[model samples]
Target: MNTRAGEAEAVDLQVQGRVAWRHAIRSLLAQPRGSIRMYSPDYADWGLGAPDVIAGLDAWAIGRSQTSVRMLGQRFEGLQRDDPRFVQWRIRFAHVIACHALPEECGGLQECLLLPEIGLLVIPSEKSRLAIYCSGARLHAAVHAFDQSWEHSTPMFPAHTLGL
Candidate 1:
């Protein structure tokens, strides 16, 4: 990955295996300075909760008040149970990070991460443990699609749960 004045150059790469996917995610997380949008059925096999990914998010959002991380998922029960570290991180950055539940109507949404400014888009296939990295027109289209889904999503995964 090459950076021109802190902006990553558009990249096109095919990533295979869990390790490569994780690396691609980390690289994507490292490049964005404005906002990051993600859509996944459930972050079950994705390493969004891994130390490095969480750390990258931490680094990206620490002092950047303008930066935002928005995530959309069909359900979060699995994520809540499987990725405690990510839940904790989300709690800490609740102000900057938002998690939403994808509306039932949008059940067929694909798993992707969009970094608009840098034109980076990541489409991951959990079953095959493969991912595609692309930019240019596809990235814009993905951003539009993600925005549509996000607009219909409901806020979820609150920072705190109130129990009586």
Candidate 2:
């Protein structure tokens, strides 16, 4: 994706699968103020299938005022059972939103992050696996898909449980 705004440029990240995924998670963790929205098949099966990333996402919900939403594919059910992030966000009354659905639910994609004021759309390339941030109706539409899923999916706990 080309960076039309000049302020938001997609960085071509070059690293091993594990390293890149970890870096993405770390980036999400460091930015405590902004929100993180991701669509993945299963965190357990994903290359970044590590405990710390889950912990970090959990920490994000519990520690920050920001919102974090996860969109799980259809085959992904109860995948967040042991995830600290799921526990922290879903049960501990943290600021978070979680959702589950089939590939059709996610509008067909692996991962995405919708940043604040940046419009929408920061996707990882299939070949390069690098992150590309862009702005347009496309991102807006993807975010809409996220919103739809979040509204429709079941929470591990309850909305009132987290006061969300």
Error of 1 at 21 (Å): 1.6
lDDT of 2 by residue, 46-75 (tens): 423345655655555565554455544554
Question: Roughly what TM-score does model 1 have, to 2 decimal places?
Answer: 0.81
Give the local distance difference test score of model 2: 0.50
RMSD versus native structure for model 2: 5.9
Give the per-residue lDDT digits (tens) of candidate 1, residues 64-164.
Answer: 66428888888898999998988999888888988899977776556787775544344544576766675655677778888888889998988888899
Give the TM-score (vs. native) of candidate 2: 0.53
lDDT value, residue 163 of candidate 1: 100
Cα lDDT for residue 85, candidate 2:
49
